[model samples]
Target chain A: MLEKANDWSDTFYDKWKPIAMGFVNGAEKCLQCGKCTGQCPAAAVNPSYNPRKIIYDLVNGNIKRVLSSVELWQCFFCSGCFATCPVDINFPFFVFMLRLGAMSQGFGWEDVKQLEKYAEKDYLQDGITVSPEERNPYVIEERGDIADIRQKAGMPRQREVSDEAIAEINMISDLSGMTNFMKKIGGVELYDCSKCTPKIEEKCKSKELPKKVGNVKTHYRFYNYGVPIGGADNA
Target chain B: MHKLDKLSGIREEIVADIPIPEEIFYFQSCVASNKYPGIESCTLDVLNKLGVKPFVSEDQTCCGGFVTFANVAAPTASMPAVARNISLAEEEGLDICAVCNGCWTFLNEFGHFMNGNDEVKESVNMMLNMMGREYKGESNIFHIGAMLYKLKDRIAENVERPLEGLKFATHYGCHYLGGGKYGAIDDAQHPSFIQELVEIMGGENVDYTASGECCGTGFTQVINDKEKSLDHSQMKLESVRDEADPDFVIVLCPYCLSQLDRMQQQLDYRRDVKLDIPIIHITQLAGLALGLPKERLAFDAHIGGQDRFKKALNKIGIDY
Candidate 1:
């Protein structure tokens, strides 16, 4: 665990506080109630993530741990906390704003950028967000199998998002700054320190970053129930 | 006009108990089209039976909910995209029936944002005007579940198979229930819309501990923290497995369907549990009740516990 000092100057609250003030009124009316955490699904699974504690941390200027913590990324955005908050605190919105602040510093979760390729492909391939083309060979094959099943059931074998819609999506994305945001955040430039050696900084410099941005810990496709139809026989 | 009035006006539309639209600008979900092809077709089929004409434009894009929720796309970008989508629907002069939960909620939230904030709406409209489109904020946004709830009586009267003897647990998809308090279909804290539908379809609606919990399709967790994401899903399923022991988990959103369907295999392998419960979308189940043929519903597209689901249907004496 990277030990971040609790210095307020080290936090991005200067930029974020204004946004929070606008939206949540600086959590000013927060009753120190633990209802947000109590109802939080993320906190239910991961004990470290507490919505109430996050608001407490923000109000107290202890934003260091809140910004850099992986727990920040763990929010399911279910808004269970938002719905349960006595003070009507919008915790999900707060988390989203906090994420933006963190991202402005290039310090938030980078894994979100993984979906950028899929969103880009949505424009080219019509509107299938997770097309078979982008998936691993196994997923592609599984998708083909599933399509075949649909076809056998007398359903249409083809479904494409509109080409015009894709054009519209591109134009809107470009016009609205989504495309640029994705490009900026999607680039892979971070080193997983957990994988670093004794000479961590030196090892990081020498290490070659993976070409694709993705979840390093999991396969591209969600786990399929059936036999592996593509890729290596063993895989 | 005050912003509060604008906000309340939008809220009034959302919470209004309006008649189901005769025609809808049916927005396609990228996830539904890819992950579960049946949801789209089944929805179309069910809507057709309900006497609703769905205008599925080839000129419509994904709602960009997943991308936005991933924090890869900011609202400044996505909100305009949403406004553009609405503008397209506005051009068609039809209210939007977002079949996916994520799309429904995000569009609703962005709709509120664009409506309440005049400056943002103006900028988005200015961008839309370039495309020869405009968003009036007059059209109502509805989730498919809400639409189904609206037509529950019609659905009940039309059931051909009558899913008696089948047990179902409803996963309303947190986006619609827990996304926010604004204009939810039913009581978010105790949503009974889908459960009511299950009963109308002649199936037993079972309630579990994590009924309102997320399926762990947490946009970020699905990308980076796969283990933690799967853990959250597993916990929900385990609660369902232990308490409800449902034959099939009913889902309104394709993403939630995928999470419940695809992750079951991972959970069974990881936790060494025998959860043979299958997951089906609400539209698919409704399609079944409406006497749609088995082949038309594309049951094989589902990933887990197909045999068990088939057997359950068999036990219910549903030949199709």
Candidate 2:
């Protein structure tokens, strides 16, 4: 059963605001502009997947409502919104925050857990996410004889990932809270702006930088836009 | 509004500004390798033909962009993983080049992250300290598509089989065009580099609405909301179909190619619709124009069959 959110206290925002600000900036500045939805390919296909409404609900502290909704999962993260937003909101990253909030609470677990296979594959194989034809017959059928095709093209088989690198990545994952985060134990901290260099801090602390409030600081640190905030104490 | 123009022409000045590097560390895509190995091989073939020999390292791992960006894992793990990947490239003393947009965007964003944030860098270095690896953040990350665009004239001079008279709708994948650092390569919304390549290769560039639209292979959306995912691809295809009938849709990103290629079949099956437009990577198209064999180009691997492209090639007198 989905965990019902009867509590709409400031604590709700406290828990989510840091994580949300970790990826996206400018949720507070959304102009009620339908531009994100107008440009959204997902919105064009599915009327319910509205970026504007998502932003609207988010700022209003409807975290659980937004996180639990099917519309939240419908974002393609094509970043059409990021491209169009006058405020330069990374709507995809905003959607990502909602995903993390959802993941933390065990919502949409079954839908997204399948990606764990690829994550594990990437770790075990050193860096390769999808398994090769021998292990995945569907891959062969879907891609139509990839290994044989490569040989015919005079290309060597895909290079092997080093065991040392694989082991290192495994250790990093273990240490970085990836293993726990995957299992929904959820202690992975994606980004921390306070850790930024002076140069990056200047870059992140732009005019659009939202004012810091109660241990939650906004760092707009995405591709030349957005910032990050360490959410939890450990984060 | 940052106008998202799909049919914008090439910015010649911007193309001129690109510092064409002699050597680069090739960052391979795990999905492209497994799903469409040909995209990787043909990309290399095009690069070599253009006189850029990229170095490949066994130590380089997946960019882990998809997993992290998809929220499958936190950036704590993925950021260090990418930093490690960049470190391997730096050790080789070469700039980083990726054929897929996702890898390039992830590496580029994470590069900025590490470079801008000393504390994150220190924490990541602490983890790497255990592995005997350290990230100094010395390399510049690029998508090979930009290189192809930058070297358009040189590539044109080298073409053996020009694809004359075919109209191509170029899907410049979202990450390549919309992502931060890469947006500077061309007009983010109104990019024309791919169309420029198409024109230089003797093909007509189809100017369509939604040409700048994504193929709808939303990273997690594909896993979580597949119907919505297919709808996204279907919307792009329908927009293309409505506006113009291009011979092929050129994409540089692996995920876009996968979604555009595979989802077309699903859209057809699910809706009984027939929008049979073949999608090819810019590298494959360039490989074909350079007279590489169809086998090397891996045209057979696409769900949208290469029949029209093959026939078009035959008409142009290139037999392989």
| Native A-B interface contacts kept, per candidate | 0.62, 0.66
Candidate 1's iRMSD: 5.2
Q: lDDT of model 1 at residue B274?
A: 66
Candidate 1 lDDT over A137-174, as tens digits, reads: 44454445656765775656667556676776678878
Model 1 stretches with alpha carbons more than 4 Å out: A1-26, A123-125, A132-144, A153-155, A185-235, B1-16, B318-320
To one decimal, what is the Cα RMSD in angstroms of model 2 from the true structure? 11.4
- The residue-by-residue lDDT of candidate 2 on A173-227, one tens digit each, is 8888787656552223334446667875653323223233212332232221112
Cα deviation in Å at residue B170, candidate 1? 1.7
lDDT, candidate 2, B1-320, per-residue tens = 12225555556575676677777788888867777777888877788888888787878778887778666677667888888899898877888888888888888877887898798899889888788888998888777887887888789899998888777888887887777533447766777667767778888877687777878777776765576677667777887777878778888888888888777777767788687787888888898799887778777667764566566666777673
For B1-320, candidate 1 gives per-residue lDDT tens digits of 11222222123355457567789988888767766777888888899999898888767777877767677666777777788788778877899898888888888888887788787789888987887778889877888877887888789878888888888888877777667566775656766667667777888867788787888877666666676687788778888889998888888888888888878776766667667778998889899899887777777677678678779878866663
Docking class of 1: acceptable
